[model samples]
Target chain A: MTEAQEKNIPDVSSDFEPKIVAFCCHYCSYAAADLAGSMRLDYPTNIKILKIPCTGKVDVLYLLRAFEDGADGVIVAGCEEGTCHFINGNIKAKKKVKYTKKILDDIGLGGDRLEMYNLSAAMGQKFADLAKEMTERIKKLGPSPVNSGA
Target chain B: MIVGEQKPIEEISKMIAEYKTVLVMGCNTCIAVCHAGGEKEVGILASALRIKNKVEGREQNIEEASMERQCEREFVDELADKIKEADCVLSLACGVGPQTIVEFYPDTIVLPGINTTFYGMPKEQGFFVEFCGGCGNCVLDMTAGICPIVRCSKSMLNGPCGGSQEGRCEVNKDIDCGWQLIHDRLKAQGKLDFMDEILPPKDWSPARHGGPRKMVREDLKIDEKPEDEIEGITKEGEK
Candidate 1:
């Protein structure tokens, strides 16, 4: 945690809704989210999914923009390692997400607010579970500290 | 190419703490190629600053702009209007970029957002190695292309020092012995005889010891400050 965020961790309300931004890769996590919808799997509606051609296209700029724009949490969803649509898009994305996490940590937003998860098209259950897990995690972390200033 | 890395966010934030409006400038050339200061990096740094300001409760007006090259006068001139409006310019270019900006807009406050690291090339993705020391002398032909000045820890010109062991430098085993590399390359090219020449000591005067150096080509001169207004131009051969 940065000095800016060391002041205090305020208690979140019982009905706090986290604004989660999910950058889902088209070949895998997007398909997983679609299948999750088709299977009638109940997940947090707070996860706003934005589809991209591949996770490699996810730049550090995109991740920072999410927090700057009031996202309580950010998720980078890509294909399972070594199973990328563009050979190594997920690998690049994984590294980028890790780098962005450090940047987020530097800004006192706490790296916990950002995460990267690998998924496959068939694993709808995993998608729903990860979303739930992320939502719960963010709920514990409360709203992003950046939002406090806004 | 000149490589650089961005400074810590805290340091950068502190630099602009006194200013309200900032123009985040970037160059799309060498620094960009090394993933330091480019257009994409401009966005990243600008966004990070915005986030930091918001998180720290600082009301700042930050804008971002990138040029083809910040080392050039024409490109640096294009950002004049933006530089004029901002309280200061945060440059995401190598050291030369900020200096160039100051040379042109003397009144504008310019700060370096990246530290100029070295003259090197990337060995692989996300990996870079220092290749040249820019010592103002060319000894590559005799050294079989391996730069003893930079590749060698001691910058030895003759041969490897006693610290060299197993084809590695004593400074670090990860670093290959520059002389050893030169030996192997020379042997392969049937130029091993050059190693036995026992070359004389290098002329340090031509290097940095001679102070700042400048080169001018008479034929390349396009600007006119009046041929007789040769205050700084030194006569080469009186031609």
Candidate 2:
């Protein structure tokens, strides 16, 4: 935990800035991100948010398109369980995320790069933390193997 | 409806590896309802192949197309233009789809993306269970509408294969014994005496043992009658 030990740890290819696409539901996760911005919370800048009517509206095609277009990681963010603006939309989104993750794994894209999260609109700090976490995780994983050589 | 599952991505990718431009075709009927192959699934699969090719450093082109029902000639004809352009076709319908395409266009290579499993009905959302064997001679009438040919583990014609334990089949406890279902249904309908009528051994000729079979309905024939049939009809008219 010392500064000397932290300094000794080799950093991942520093020049490698991951491109993450996040599909955020307008009712919750999108508003949470907005609140984080207004609250002056700091988070990674690598994530590009695409606000959808609901996480249920986040089609598997969109997630695949992000990877096809060189996104290193993808996230589907929706309202917390039982609070989806469209009842059960978040649950459906979670199932879709799981299915899409399996597709990524089948196609050798590393399912770990895709994830689903749930949060209320008031959870600005949590939203910021997720962004920072996803960025760090993706950085450790390096570039998406699908487009790495391209 | 015919139910099928998509083949593994590895196998499908390998099948199209030699081809530069592969068309991924989907059927919007049975396979679509089962979520095996549909318009949406075609796009997903095409995208997956493109990503896989990129990862493997292969420059393969994958195209997507769909048909309302791949088994019919009219629906299969819709892909005439796309079929001519692609090096090969990867049909996501049941086994019939690719075969139909192969029959219509013998010069083109048609590959099956899904494995045709069985004639089944959706038991629930996302779950399909086999229900029919298409034995040519239907025995559902005598069996209280239950198909013992397919529903029974051993296809017993007379009764349960003496392996019926309680109401479940001996092959699997989860499966309800086919004979048991028949007995229950017949008993409920006051037709229990039908079970003791001693049915005869099925004529295997009508089944698949007769080789590939075709059903022709003279009443539904749209084309001209055969020469022999026409001559017979003319003689009858003259008489």
Candidate 3:
């Protein structure tokens, strides 16, 4: 940290901790998370993973509720294209995520807070990389405005 | 069924901005089936409105209620008590629901949350196509059950318009030429001879051109006196 920049950091920002929610599909992204753990790969601890049958099961309501409940960011992780165990669950999820992004933008949460990522069960390193990437993006964006005190 | 869609959230929010207490009323019948205004949709909208209010730092109270059919008086009566508590009612039913609520509660402000697009059935899941014009005339027998008044872009009665190209509508490439569909249907039934028959000009008096239409059945009308009042003398004679 630069000496001048480090000295001016507000106490609130120094203590600011982002809360991220991940909706992971059981057949792919969830298993990938498991693989990441088995490999002892490091990922941000702020991310809370919720295991779902498929990313298609992630309702727009659920994503909205996460933000309403003070989530700083949300990630819907599903199987890669053409490899969804449920035929097209991941494909459907991508559409839902795109739709939810519009809603977020409409409601002033800035859309960037929600994203959809796809990975295979064997991509442990990719999962770790996404976790760190999402965390940094959210940290730069700061806490969700939806969670800001009214 | 009546097909309608929810108004954009921005539009709805702007409507209820001045009101502190807003009630979102949903209809369980037509709008529900169309995925527009239903119980679940009401909840979603109510939440969205609350979130919008929070983001804007506006103190607002939003409530939700759903009725079986918003067009009927009895079903609308169910919201009587709740209606009194609200400053404005945001009706999520088709256009009829808001009108019904307005008639029942003339003093209250009732807002429309949907634009009633058409009287149609679900062509497929999440898709609706207009099929009936309610022109107060029935000519399905002559057209093999197709109503050209609704299906045809030009409402052509006799035959396909020359503008039709390859069985597709000239106006919209995605739309099938309504006359082409009629021709295929009539051909399948071996009723191609009907194609040569000339149809008379349609009488549009029963349509909206005659202003709002009302159908009254004399047999269905009740007498001025109740059944008990009329039958009282007969019951005494029997006794």
Top-TM-score candidate index? 1
Q: What ranges in model 3 sit over 4 Å off? A: A1-14, B218-239
- Alpha carbon lDDT of each predicted model: 0.89, 0.88, 0.86
Q: What would the per-residue lDDT of candidate 2 be over residues B94-153, giving only the tens digit for each residue?
A: 988988787677777999899989999998988888899988889888999999988899
Q: Candidate 2, after superposition: displacement of residue A51 in Å?
A: 1.9
Model 3 per-residue lDDT tens digits across residues A1-150: 656346632234455678999999999989999999999999999889999999888877788778877898999999999998899998888887887788777776668999899999999999999999998888877666566653
- Order of models, best lDDT first: 1, 2, 3
The lDDT leader among the candidates is 1
Per-model DockQ against the true two-chain complex: 0.67, 0.54, 0.45
lDDT at B40, model 2: 88
What is the C-alpha interface RMSD of model 1? Answer: 1.5
Q: TM-score for all predictions?
A: 0.93, 0.90, 0.88
Q: Which ranking of candidates, highest TM-score first?
A: 1, 2, 3
Between candidates 1 and 3, the one scoring higher on lDDT is: 1
TM-score of 1: 0.93
Q: In model 2 chain A, where is the ten-residue run with the lowest total lDDT?
A: A2-11
Model 3 residue A127 CA deviation in Å: 2.2
User: Fraction of native contacts in model 3?
Assistant: 0.37
Return the clash pairs for model 1, or none.
none
